[model samples]
Target: MQFKHPEILYALFLLVIPIIVHLFQLRKFQKESFTNVAFLKQITLQTRKSSQIKKWLTLLTRMLLLACLIFAFAQPYTASKNQFNTQPETVIYLDNSYSMEAKGEKGPLLKRAIQELIENLDPEAPISVVTNTTSFSNTNLKSIQNELLQLPYAPNALPFEAALLKSEKLFSNKPNSPKNLVFISDFQEQQKPFSKPLDTSYTLHAVKLKPQVESNVSVDSVAVTGKELGKLKLRVFLKATGPTAGTVPVSVYNNQTLLAKATIDFSETNVTTFTLTENHIPNGKIVIEDAGLPFDNVLYFSLNKPEKTKVLHIHHQDNLDVSYIERLFNNPEFEFSTTFLNNLNYSVIENQQLLILNELTTIPSSLINAIQSFIKRGGYVLMIPNSLANLQTYNAFLEPYNMVMQAGITSEKRVSKISYAHPLYKNVFEKQETNFQYPKVASYYPVKANTSSVALAFEDGKPFLVTQNQLALFTSPLNKTNSNFSEYDLIVPTFYNIAQQSLKTARLYFTIGEENSFDVPVAMQADGVLTLHYNEQTTIPLQQYFNNKVTITTTDIPDVAGFYQVQDKQNPISTVSYNYARAESKLSYQNLENLEQVQVSSAINTAFDTIKSDTKINALWKWFVIFALVFTCIEMLILKYFK
Candidate 1:
């Protein structure tokens, strides 16, 4: 028995004082008065035993009162059994994420959670088991127990919140019954919360998931390129998510035949590349047979033949700086062209995959509007600041779409901290053969602020390389007045990454960090069917959105699959020529740290009915009060009869 207020029992010590008073209440048997009455005085002493008996009776009453008072204060209660049950209906949310695959003392977490539910089930109680799989639904113990044995691992993802909400809604339908929720999962913090369940309404039983101690290696991402029908070049990101680093050999195969192979020097960002020599090989899986983690071992992609996306650069002026950009960007994918702003027509924004804003601070209002429209419609714009740059005017062009560049300078010393996470650094330098500093910008103008912009490069701890919300506007600080402007290393990768992003030929096969939404332009109507021809044979119809300019978002392109060519049959003008720009080359990888945030819902609170029990354990305290009442009535009757 547990006492809610056991300390109050100290008051029982007062019983001693009452006992003393009761003893004193016994009168001397009136022996002297009896002597005055001239007889029976001898018998007075004989009645002394009666006096002692009355004193003892008074003591017994005091003891009873003290016992009653102590019992009231201590408030002892028995642990409730069956809770005077209203037949509880419980919703058990099972955390079935990849992390749940970790083994537990009982068994695999999935089976253990199920077993725990079965053991905890009161025969009178009803329960629903949810695995958080896409097929999650409410099912009774008899109906789902057999199904649990055949539960297949879900491939999509752990949707913690969605599962919880579904549980809550199912429990809500049953009223008056006691509701309770039991959850089993790794309880990753990255998971989002579902409907907030009230504490009074349900009991929360949280089952902790076992920790992950084993090393893991996963494929963080993969990219494919070349415009040909089947000849595919693949770059895969192999991350050794384990505590220590190691190397692994990743091979690329077309069907069962080994096409190309590369030994990846492993790190957190373990990367390897291989080329499928022959073009027109549409479908195949590139497998990393020896990575520690199996989830990322193999990636599936459809390869296209040799193809490159074109980028036309329009510079404000043709000078040494502009010539360097033109030469660095001279490749099959990029058909480089440039003219003075005055010589170029306004419609150039419409024709080019990307436009370079070099040394042009003051843009024509029409050009600014065109650029803004292009940006909203998902066009790529790379802005390089110059000595005579107008920060206010440039910001005006980027302001609407969540971007601004303000820190002005002729130059300040800076260097690109190669973010291997960035596609630019992914496969470029695999193993560090030499301590190549690449190139350093002696001076730069960092973006004064960022809203939708992510600081890709830093200058004196300020953002020098910034990407806009959609990643469409890539701004860099190229203080043209700085002596470093003529260097090749400093300018090449910047143009390469930004230009590649614009061409849309480089298919990003993974989603890690947040990416901005950029325009996917095809001359098509809002409702037109845009086909993505991965190779010569496979064509996938892409969904479109009708905004100011017919634009499409790129968030849906996370999968590694065949090439695509968008086609709008209704509007013949809306057609995009399919091409592959994937550069197949293998390189060692950088060790990228895992994100600390848990990306799945914890499903902490389950849903159940609120059944109020008619009898509570608190009723035990009432027993002592009732005993006092009955004793008081008896004492009153006895006193009246005796008097």
Candidate 2:
């Protein structure tokens, strides 16, 4: 038991005053003679003894009554040890990710958690609430009640470790303060295992909100699986959790018009395909009817009108085997052209997206300056060194990229290693092919390269092809006498993707909360800026202006998933789509009960109750008040009834 105002306890010393008054009676008694003194003397002795006992009883009761009143005024209470001296600090981590849209016993998990927090939390206690995208620090529940009620779901979920770190940072630095870190989420299983933090300054409590049913299906992804003359066959990937069966209806919409509708037989398959006309859907949406999670029920994608990438090849007039360059860029997606070094039109260099210097013996200083400026303006360049190329001239052009041309190596080396994870081959191959026919080069120049820059290596681990930002270099020329690389199957994707990436056009779609960059081909004034528009919402994305295009990079601005129009003020350039990632669609969760130094519960209110119990105060002052009243009644009975 502890006293709130212990200074009132000094009044206990006043009990000595009552004892003094009882022992030394201040009232004087008169002695008088009366008849029958002998019998009267015996009766007086009995009366005096009984009266003395009564006075002692009354004094004991009165002293206890005064002590009880003093204790009651002191406001004494019983509570957990050290709770009276420790200050409590609480921080709550609320997971507002899309997976929280799952239904619990009450309602949506996020919504129910919010309601419980508002209902159970101390209205005036200082607390901090950490969400995925926002934080309400050092605030009371009454102040952030409205904000918690309207909190929206985030596209990205904060990692469990990150959330723990964030919660700890919000706590006060005062030592020995009782800190409670409450984590309220569904405890979804992530790609990596949760590393438990070892900090002992705070107590960790986890409330795992489980859904009523574990069965849920989600639209995983949409991709063009096949293509024909004027139609594109798209496949929709679906993912299910637990035991889900039966056919689900899927619909494809272009703007407000329905393009096609189909049903996927879940009992037999997890995929369905739909064929639509080419160049028809500038803004496309694929939706599935599911009663599970709502965020992944629909997928958004954009297929804008195609733009041909410009390719220009500069070669020496003496070289006659330019068949490989011509055949690779012969598709309808690229506008391929060639020119001799003597006939190089410097005026057209700025318009081309990719420039291939095929077998150039000497790079003129004037042409080198033009190519350098072109590359600096977001253009790509591929350098194929001639067999007898002048090293001094080539080294001057390669000096800025931390590369140089070395003397030729007269050895036959086969191209055996491919950096399968390079951006050039991101999705080019389904798996790493180890048994493909290796292409051999009879004689080649040896150029040093950074370990990360080597996209393809020779059998001796020398760089056969190295690529830096906006530049790709081959150690040797591809002429039939020097190498047979032009005849192999590896040359198509290598050269084709270079031209394709140079344009930076819109992809099928992009995921939100990721670093997404693309180019908008529009000439803007020096002060002009680009903005994204989606249903009356406009946001200016981070953009870098170039000669004929603007490179736009977005991470967290356009948070909603939908088709956004890339606009220069009001004029539209193109359309791009953003969609939430499908990571939380499967509904797998982690079991946190076995974690060390953490208390696990299944409800938000229960977790709060545990925290409340830690600092709960059981006031003994009311019981003391009742004791004071009883002592007063006992003293009155002794004074009135005992005599």
Candidate 3:
């Protein structure tokens, strides 16, 4: 019990005044004659005894009544430990990610959470509310109630650790105050678990809002699987949680017009294919009908016009067999050309995507500078050293890439190992093959590089092919007398992917939170810039201007998932697409009950009630007032009826 005004309790000392008056009498009675000697003695003795008993009873009642009144006036109250002495501070972290779109018992989880928060929290109490994209700090619920109701879902979900840190920062710096952190979310499990423990300063109350159903079908991914005669075959991958069966409808649209529709049988397979005319649909959209989360039902993608990669090969001699190089890049996808070292045109090198230094005996200072400049502009280089090349001139170029060339090794080495995990060979082979045809190289120079740089290793653990960023090196020449690599099966994919990487075209779609960069084939003025347009929104993304293209990098901008036009001011260059991350589409949740030092509850109301209990005050002054009235009645009965 605590008191509002403890000084009123000092009034108990004043009760001593009544005790003193009862004990010491100011008036004295004179001796009176008795009617009869024996009768007077008996009457006096009985009367004195009765008077003494009555006076003691009345004095005890008066003291008890005065004490009760003093306590009542003091306004004593009982509450939770220390709740009456400290101010309560609250910070709420409301997860407004797309995963909250799942339906609960009443409605959508996010919508229902908002309604309950407004209904349960005190209107006048100060609080801070944090969400994935927005926050209201040190404000009352009445002030931000409308904003909470109109909150939109965010494309990216904030990590649990980040949200905890943000919530802690929102708390005030007052000492000895009771602080509470209410974390409300669906608690979706991510690829990485929340390993960081929560802070112990504030009491953490976690509310894990669960949906009624766990079954959800999401469009996992879309890719260009194959190409037919004049059409492009696209594969749509779908994922489902819980017991899913039967067929689901899938549709493909070009802008707003429906292009094709199909059905996927979950009992048989999760992937379905659609064939559309090549380059016919610039704005591609794939949608699925599922009674689960709505945010992942549709995926947006773009298919811009194809751009051919330019290849330029500079050979040592004009008569050397360059037909093999020509055959590799002869397709319509690549612009292939060759010239002898003596007749190489320096001006044309700036516009090429890949440069092949075919068995060059010596690299001039001027040509080396040109190649370095080309590489800085995002060009790729494949260097095949000549058997008798000048080591001094070669090392000069290799030094900048942290590579060195040693004396030539006359012993023949066979190329045996392939780094399948390397980006050049990723997805090129269906399976890992242990036994295959090996090519031999005679009279090869030994190139030493970092262990991670080796793409193809020789039988003796020497680097047959090593690559760094934008530069690939072949330790030996591929001529008929020097090596048989040109005749091997590995030549096609090895060269094809290297050229493909040189000109990184836009993917079908990029996730909103991942690192994505693509080249837009356009030349802009020094003062001009590129902007992404979707509906009425325009965003200026991070970009670097090059000679013939603009490299645009995106991470967090263009928050909406749709087809956006890449424009240089008002002139539209191309189209790109973005989609929300699929991490939350699986409908899997984390088990938070095992957390220590934190209060976990399944319902939002239960979590809020726990917080209220900590600060709940039970006033005892009313009970004390009733006790004072009862004591007064006892005092009146003692004075009137006891005698």
TM-score of each: 0.55, 0.88, 0.89
Q: Compose the digit string of candidate 1's lDDT tens values, residues 474-531.
A: 3443544464544646456666777766654423332312232323444554455644
Model 1 is weakest, by summed lDDT over 10 consecutive residues, at 578-587
- Worst lDDT run of 10 residues, candidate 3, spans 191-200
* lDDT tens digits by residue: candidate 2, 1-643: 8888889999999889989988898875456699779987888888879988987898888899989999999999876645666679999999999999999989999999999998899899999999999999999999999999999999989888888898889999988688899999998898765545885588889899999987788888888876688888988888888877688899999998999999988999999999888555888999999889999999999988877888999999564689878889888778899999999999999988899998898999999999999999898999999888999999999988988789998888899999998888889999999898999998888886553388888998889889989999999888888888998888988888888788888788999989999988777898999999999999999999877778899998789999999988889888999999888887889988678878899998889898888878888889989999999999888888996
State which candidate, 1 or 2, has the greater lDDT: 2
Clash number for model 1? 51
Between candidates 2 and 3, name the one with more favorable TM-score: 3
Query: Which candidate's lDDT is highest?
Result: 2
Number of clashing pairs per prediction, in order:
51, 0, 0
Question: What local lDDT does model 2 show for residue 49?
Answer: 90
Query: What lDDT score is found at residue 181 in candidate 3?
Result: 91
Task: Give each model's whole-structure lDDT.
Answer: 0.53, 0.88, 0.87
- lDDT value for model 3: 0.87
Query: What's the lDDT for candidate 2?
Result: 0.88
Which sequence of candidate numbers ranks them by lDDT, best first? 2, 3, 1
